[model samples]
Target: MSEVERPARGVSDLGELLATMRPELDPDAWVFATAAEPLAGAEVTVVEAEGVTSVLRKHDLPTAGDAPARMRVSPPFARITLQVHSDLEAVGLTAAVATALAAEGIPANVVAGFFHDHIFVPWPRASDALASVRALQRDAARAGDARG
Candidate 1:
């Protein structure tokens, strides 16, 4: 008997999904599409496109030789990842997360990856955002998606 390929699981339940996904925030401040590509002496790099990169590094000034082209490193942000295998075709995860954060007056800049969705919000408000997201999960698990 030929073994059939197991399909990737995609969650459509807003409440159940969020309830289990352990979202986390990065401690270091990260830059958004500003650093020069192929940067040396960096801690983390998110993306490299169009000769620029969004990098996460220690809170230290860059050397003149490695300075970013244009940086707006203010109101430092934190990265939160939904630890779940999310389907790209799946609808409403992004909207739901954003909406929940918005309800707490926390702005969310979402980036959807193959296996997960990421939200970047103000650094100081990261805890607040995390709490809000967790609460959303609880509400969803209890209410089964009130967004209908």
Candidate 2:
């Protein structure tokens, strides 16, 4: 018999998923730089040189620093980055991850880049959070198999 192709699985059982996924540690919590400067410091990269005034006035960015430089935003959550080969934007991936985390009572913030998707969750719940995400992946795989 020829093996059937399967449709990819999406997140389903959150509890079981969290139990299986290994938690990872995130180094930096908050990264800040000038709007004009290159994105550096943390995993999340910020580009475009908008002045601090512009960020504050237009984007409602917190004015903690005095200088104007390119800003990259990543609120530290116990974060895990998945290398998704699919052409999904950061916001879409974030929404998917957030949906899974929410089911487990884990709050998450997502930062997207060109290569991978980054998820930030509360430091305390990092392990549980990672497990939750991994579970989602497994569930997706299972669903894909079922379709095939």
Candidate 3:
């Protein structure tokens, strides 16, 4: 059997990272909920002193009639995953993304995984957020081109 080779490290150059980042938005509505136990199908989960917080699709949630009385859920959000495999040590990427979104008055909740960064924004502003992110990438790419 052959072993698959992985890149020694993800892209760390800010310019390259931004120039190549491809943001893909998930169409489903996701929400942050706090429950006593972790949700079975949660995409992200964190255990805190208060309770377990999970980010999962709204459709995965149980109907109100069958819901737990103690579950606390937040407003629906849209998940935008940056397709670029960014290095863990990469700097400025989060700041740049946050700045771009903040300029348009969108609140971003960023989560960094081993290889990529995910941004969650209000569901209503998903399109706007996507445009802003794409613009950031476009501008960076143009700058890189000019430099070359």
Candidate 4:
């Protein structure tokens, strides 16, 4: 059996990349922070930042004003990952993705990591955002295939 090409990479063709990579949203809510290290067990975003040490825990993590981590996003945030290996400098990907979400009145916080683009939409509207993203992927695929 031939292996299935989930997300065709190296195309760099924004349209094709968006079409092939079916972005999936995680069920558990997530958050971001400039953590010196990864949260002990929580699946969170931790990056190297020059400052006092910190950790990326869920919103439930105790914090207060004057705390190194002043901001605490409650109700958490929904995380979605586009499985395409888009280059860091890739143009139009983030814009297009954000535009789609915005059109549906869904706010998206995009985080461009090494392998894929992570989107954090409001937890309440996460399902709607996922639907919008899936629709965009389907439409892009249809358009790309039709051009052939």
Candidate 5:
């Protein structure tokens, strides 16, 4: 279908969103940092009262000599982007995913974009986090089937 024919708002049904969200883990290592301004290759940036928070690949950061004098960098992370096109107003998606990861003793950093929801978890726990999310999707699908 053409873009014009597509639904203006992506999937809004919570069950459908959960059941169909195909989480894909990215291959690159990422980091969260606070800088005076977003660096050259940030994938996402949020401006807050404290400063600009940038999410970028680890390799994208500048060397110490070229970097900002006072940037604070977080631990390495791995990103997993949900393939499902979720509506901005959709509820429960983030909570459900986060809860699942939390149960596995993993911390989830979720970022909602216009097209997808991106999740960042500790680099060492990326695979486990992905598996947890996929299991949640499977359970949701089974529940949806039962409802049908």
Candidate 6:
């Protein structure tokens, strides 16, 4: 009898895979603060400014603040953010991570920036989603080691 070979699962060398995957970023990249107290409705616009600002605009979003020096956001799923290295581009990493999360039954929106990649996921599933990302990284590392 002939033995069937199983296909490789998971990504290896997340960084390198990410380098090759070429993921794309969503156009609109921002998430309203759903965790803050009182839950003021504010359209959190990640402006390229110095500090957080309470813009009294006609919007329900409670906190309108400026993102840090190097930050990004994913749309729709507004509760999670994927803090990344400043030097990295947003598209590749964000897309790879989003695809991985989707495979795990977790939906995510990715936003790209000049520095890092951000992911917004449902608040309830944020932790699990993050774990999935860590797993991706680990698998990548393992695969990279094997290649070397």
Residue 138's lDDT within candidate 2 is: 78
The CA lDDT at 112 in model 1 is 78
For residue 57, give model 2's deviation from the true position in Å: 27
The CA lDDT at 47 in model 4 is 46
Candidate 3 TM-score, C-alpha based: 0.91
Candidate 5 per-residue C-alpha lDDT over 1-148 given as tens digits, one digit per residue, 9 for 90 to 100: 6575555798989999999999999999999999899887998999999999999999999889989968999999999999999999998999999999999999999999988999999999999999999999999999999999
lDDT string for model 6 (11-118, tens) is 333466543332223333235332312233333333434534322122344334733332222233433444434343222565668788999899875544443456
Q: Give the better candidate number (2 or 4) by lDDT.
A: 4
Ranking by lDDT: 5, 3, 4, 1, 2, 6
Candidate order, TM-score descending = 5, 3, 4, 1, 2, 6
Compose the digit string of candidate 4's lDDT tens values, residues 1-148.
Answer: 9997654444467887788877888877665544444334444454445522222336545455434443433456788889888877678888988999999999888877667888988888998998988988999999999997
- Candidate 3: tens digits of C-alpha lDDT, residues 1-148: 9998865799999999999999999989999999898886798999999999999999998778876669999999999999999999999999999999999999999989889999999999999999999999999999999999
Candidate 6 whole-model C-alpha lDDT, 0 to 1: 0.49
Each model's RMSD to truth, in Å?
5.1, 10.4, 2.7, 6.8, 3.4, 16.1
Question: How many pairs collide in each candidate, listed in order?
Answer: 0, 14, 0, 0, 0, 10
Worst 10 residues of 5 by lDDT: 1-10
Worst 10 residues of 2 by lDDT: 51-60
Candidates 4 and 5 compared by lDDT, better number: 5
For residue 38, give model 6's deviation from the true position in Å.
20
Error of 1 at 4 (Å): 17
Overall lDDT per candidate, in order of appearance: 0.71, 0.52, 0.95, 0.72, 0.95, 0.49
TM-scores for all candidates: the values are 0.70, 0.53, 0.91, 0.71, 0.93, 0.48
Model 2 regions more than 4 Å off: 1-40, 45-76, 88-92
| Index of the highest-TM-score prediction | 5
Error of 6 at 41 (Å): 11
Steric clash pairs (candidate 3)? none
